[model samples]
Target: MHKRMAMLAFIILVVAWGIPSAKAACSTPVVNASFGSVTSFAVNSTASTSSGSLSVNCGSSLATIFNTDTISVRLTASTFASGTQAIMKKVGDSSGDNIPITVCLSVQNCGSPMTIGAPATTFNSTQLSIFLLTGGKNFTIPLFFSTQPGQTVAAGTYTTTLSFLTNWDICTGLGVGIGGIQICVIDQNGSATLSLTVTLEVTNDCTTILAPAVNFGTAPLLSSFSSVVQTISVTCTKGSVYTVGLNDGIHAVNGVRNMASGSNLIRYDIYQSTTNNRWGSSIASQRWSSTNATSVSTNQLIRNYNYTATLLSGQTTPVEGNYSDTITVDLSF
Candidate 1:
């Protein structure tokens, strides 16, 4: 009986020693945040908004204990040009300039001037919580950014790298970084950068609206020196210098421009002023040149040039028919 009792006690001790501990080993949470390329922000834009998504992945160990975990992301302020959080030209630029822009996690939270690299306090502000499932959880975070009104920058493809930091809770009812909480930074993805690139594109643009054709209506074949005044309207970037040139008509001989009717030709000439100086196709002999300064609005600048065309008097009288000519107008900036 004594031997049996001793064996039973040994068996109980072995069974107790083989049992696993109640406290399970915790695995570090895995996190990955990503966003697509933002849409181009236009220069001189009053207001614009762009959106993207962030993805977060949690490990099985962390998911087993907690059904939900909190995460906080912070955007580090840009260091380009006076520490402004703006985009800069990536190539072919001598001046290292930045385009001013405003970024936010949501439209309502914009323009608050929150410090970069600072920790987000509340989920409504910049922090969000993810709900874990049986195996694990994949969370999607939405991001939004807006640009300041009346912002103008240089013309180029601007780019900037935005840095983000993520912090999450490891255990149930435990706040972030409280009582051995875990934090996974953007660079924790093993050589995979956790960053989003913000891009803005600025282009120098101009639009030209030509006036209706000048009609020297229904004149007799013997009519001498018929003339008409025509105008050309142009709108270009503010402070942009541009020139307008009118090419010689289809019927021309050795730079002498003319108009035509079927096989018949009528000699004519285009002049920049009433003084009758001929307007040529070359830039040096352009009909009009000016620096655009007339701002019709914040986004538009307008300029007008007047030209006169005359029918030469020495042409022999020809058969009466509809006469017309097409001239190619060239605008150079």
Candidate 2:
């Protein structure tokens, strides 16, 4: 009686090994499409980028009975998406400040991306794998992203959320008779939504500076030389406080700026205000400041600094030749 009971139990275990398991389910996504701390000028000058992956996993159900599974992720705009492209806006800002962006699978050129709320585009090609090896076909879709250029936005964090759809085919190998192995046990429509949080950061800074050329044109004598005024235009991040400094000219002697003509020096000075004080490269020398006490509210706030270059009266007249000197301009924040 004991031998018969052991044989019956062994037969039951063999039958259970051949039976199919339950259907497969994928893991929920936690993704972020983040471009950390990008300057406003960087986003405007070129594409700012961030990336995250979308993954798929089917259950391990008897590799002997299954060949390999194929998968294709389709990127479609979600329910909350409105435009034909993804747009990020400043968090908690209701003034409608937005930055348009795009996502791509290939890094060659993000030229063509799927529309935000239109037909679906395949995120990746058919992912092929052997069912027995590499359990659940461990794979991750390579997502590339870029923000559209030419945006002059305020300094802060910008954010948006995008949606996607994924489709997969879980196949089974049934027979080794006709054409080797046959495909069977298709999925009963597998799909999932991915909410991709896109974020960007803009820091307060001075972006651009347009220095002026002070042309003290053609003065035959020292006393006849007139003061020349020129403007320095500066573009900075909105609300950022900054200062501009000008170094003494390349040709100088005893703290006095000089224009050199073949070692013949002519004295001159550059002042922030008309005869107030010479503009030198130091905070103590009183660099031009962007703000007094209030924030600059405009985007790419351009401030103009007018300076006067006067030929000093004490210097004797030099020979008849062209004299020029170069001064270095710097920005501090």
Candidate 3:
């Protein structure tokens, strides 16, 4: 009976000694990640993305102890200055213009709603587990960005810094604070940083649609002067300053514009407004200037201008048939 009791005590000691008594120590690893600049952002850009890589070395010792690990990555929200999502804009610009941006591990990463700068906005693989093998692991995450169509913003090179945070846990079945196994928490001790740059260009553009011809049809010769109204439609980029001018008609002499029928010419003048102020070559006084300041969520803005043309009272009508002249419309922005 004494020998049996001693053998049982020895067996208990062996079993207790076989189990680990301390938590495994892991060396902090350096994460090597980088991405290039994205240059496709425009005023009409819908969405754009830049591809990058994330890789880290866990070392053989740490991988052996923690065979499997679950990892999630978070980005610092303060880096983005606009909205709930990440944004970019011209460096050193005082203007409050910005372009909305976001980051994702895959299409699945974008599915989860995340607020900028919050740790809850993390990216991880839901379908698969990340294992810390002998060699380590690498991942691919893309930065997604977008701008509204016809968005009016300052044009320049925009830059921002992206800081990464990583959280990890061991896949061991053992509970924390039991049997010498402690809670697993992997902090971003040596995460990598990427300097992201985006560029935008603002261009001035305009489209002009001319109205139908002003027909002073069948006016009685040597009768009272005839008058007609004409119009032009101009669409331009928002916030663009522009000027509109009407050149001398094809038949002109010493600034006396005329409509001709064969060899006979009838004098006429174009007024800028109903007030009868002449529309001429000078941009300061005789031309029309306006600002495309109408705020629109989408599409370019249109501005219309109307002018009146009148035949001079002193015109002596001679042989007449179909009388016409082409006046060129000029727009400068």
Candidate 4:
């Protein structure tokens, strides 16, 4: 009965010995990628750039008990970005032409293109599940590129600086308690930043050249062969100030273009106009300057060259066989 006469209770407070959060830093957080030496058509098509990493260095006590940590990477637009897309400006361009681009965690499988300005990009859950190792732990988050193609801008070097925010959480436990309970012993929560200097060198290119066969049609007399007044479609890079010319054909004696049949030849010439402005290989003065640039489904600026190919008058008509000549379509930009 004397056992109920006394009761003892003890409480202990360890303020100075409390468990503190771990330290976090991005020792090598640089994401560098390049499409390199691509054509303007490449900017209007689907392609992937080389990969880089969001390298992180961790120093914490989580490796002892929980042996794990976590992190999340989110995109945010910087000074060089506008809206949800990144604009790469062409170097030395007076027009300030911009090529819009995007980045992703995957290649062409970019279901969620990073809307960095909106800060609405999805975080990589699998990559965030970090397992802290002994001594030190290094976490690498790979970054890939997925551009928003169909941009018909100037051809040159396009570049921009892209940055992203990284968040990390270090925990002291494995986040699972005994009896299947949800345990959360977060030791640290920190954030950092990283950048990607992307370069896209766009060379001038001729994407499409639809030159139909120059058929003078069968003619009994050389002077009776009707001139060809068809259209030659030339699609080149947008903003490419260029000149289009026709090189001397395979059978060019002197300055006259001749279609050959065995030893026989049919003299002819291609002119920019029906009134005798010969479209020769000399682009310095005799070039057909670029006209208005129009876009097609391929996002290329297509220019139409209307030229007339006429059989030289007063020339002897060749033999009754098919006389053909190959002419090179030339461009000087």
Q: What is the lDDT of residue 39 in candidate 2?
A: 80
TM per candidate comes to 0.52, 0.65, 0.58, 0.68
> For residues 55-152, what per-residue lDDT tens digits would candidate 4 score against the true structure?
66655334333334567667776434567677778656667567776676534457776767555333332444442334455566676765567677
User: Which parts of model 4 have CA positions greater than 4 angstroms off?
Assistant: 1-28, 59-63, 67-70, 79-82, 87-102, 105-113, 117-135, 169-190, 215-228, 241-243, 260-262, 282-300, 313-324
Task: Name the best candidate (by lDDT).
Answer: 2
Q: Per-residue lDDT tens digits of candidate 3, residues 191-257? A: 3333444333445666445557878878567465468887767766544567778888899978888
Each model's lDDT comes to 0.54, 0.67, 0.54, 0.66
Error of 1 at 165 (Å): 8.6
Q: Residue pairs in steric clash, candidate 2?
A: none
Per-residue lDDT of 163-245 in model 2, one digit per residue for the tens?
77766555432311123534353332367876777788888777577886888788778898789988787888765677778
Whichever of 3 and 4 has more lDDT, that candidate is 4
Give residue 233's lDDT in candidate 2 (0 to 100). Answer: 79
Taking the tens digit of each residue's C-alpha lDDT, what string does model 1 give over 147-194?
555543434566555565655443322112223543221111211224
Model 2 C-alpha lDDT versus the unseen true structure: 0.67
